[model samples]
Target: MIRNKKEYKQYLKRDRLALEIYNDGIINKLKNLFFPNPIWTFQKRMRKLEYYTNCKNYGLYKLYIYYLKYRYRKISIKLNFSIPINVFGPGLSIVHYGTIVINFTSRVGANCRMHACVNIGASGGEVQGPQLGDNVYIAPGAKIYGNISIPNNTAIGANAVVNKSFSEENTIIAGIPAKVIGKVDIKKIIKYV
Candidate 1:
């Protein structure tokens, strides 16, 4: 998160790429997507900008965030991520960007990888959004919501609707109102990352 000057500078670099993607034509974006660079990708920059916005300390950060808000709106027309900045930790990896809507109230841990069409929203007023732990991998079209506490190293399968919490760490949760399906090797999933 932008705790100091160095991190803030990094955030700016990422934001600059994001702006380039937005202002530049579709061909450039497609080229970057095909020949992907970790620093130049949309997901990386978005997450980095989100990290900066979460830190409410510096005026410069706030001003940059304000500029990002405008670009974010433009970008959201093609790729939607309405998640609040403070909700997610660092190392948030988005596999693909299309119709992904994460509620602002949701809290996701570090190094979480999410695919396309994933929704993490509120179930009710009393219950807030889901709280996901570290090294969580959410597959495509997963709809996870409510006051669920997903433990570390958990994997939510594709098209799964996780309404209930799975407390077991290093487990795979799938199906509607999701339950523990099986165990997973957390180390294997995170080793390359």
Candidate 2:
């Protein structure tokens, strides 16, 4: 489906407003007090905007990102690496991004998603992270760092870890150590718009 120009403008406007609210209230205040610089502010604002943009329409967001990537090649390159936005799927809901890293060795399945401040990196400094399966959704501020195998139809709750393997499907993984909490249907995981 083609999202119209008007719709795109509305999305961008709403997005920027929401970001400004967050930044003015939380981010900028902390950033100014701790690390006072324009570069950090630029990166922070870009990440937050990128998060909202990702949760919007893919084609529209892609064009916007392409423009920014062209405008600021150096910043865009580093942003792409520092924050792993679409590590799982296109319809991923990203908001308020921060030090998020999705490992290159790991492979995430279709219909899978994640939110802001998520780190899917290697564990033990040797064994890599889990290979995520289809319909697996993770929440905000979550960290999944370890050698594991996540099956299809699983939901890793906010700030949880799956440091083990699940050969079966339809499960809920949560907590610091990370374990199966409950079962969930795969169909419930995919719903765009």
Q: What is the C-alpha lDDT of each candidate?
A: 0.71, 0.58
Q: What is the C-alpha lDDT profile of model 1 across 1-193, one tens digit per residue?
A: 4565466555454444323444368877787668665323444546556666655537767888777766656666656655555565555666666777888778987667778889999887745788999888889999998887899898889999998887788899998868888999876755423
TM-score of predicted model 2? 0.54
Candidate 2: worst-modelled 10 consecutive residues by lDDT: 84-93
What TM-score would you give candidate 1 relative to the actual structure? 0.74
Alpha-carbon runs more than 4 Å astray in model 2: 1-96
Per lDDT, the best of the predicted structures is 1
lDDT of 2: 0.58
Q: Residue 115 deviation, candidate 2, in Å?
A: 0.8
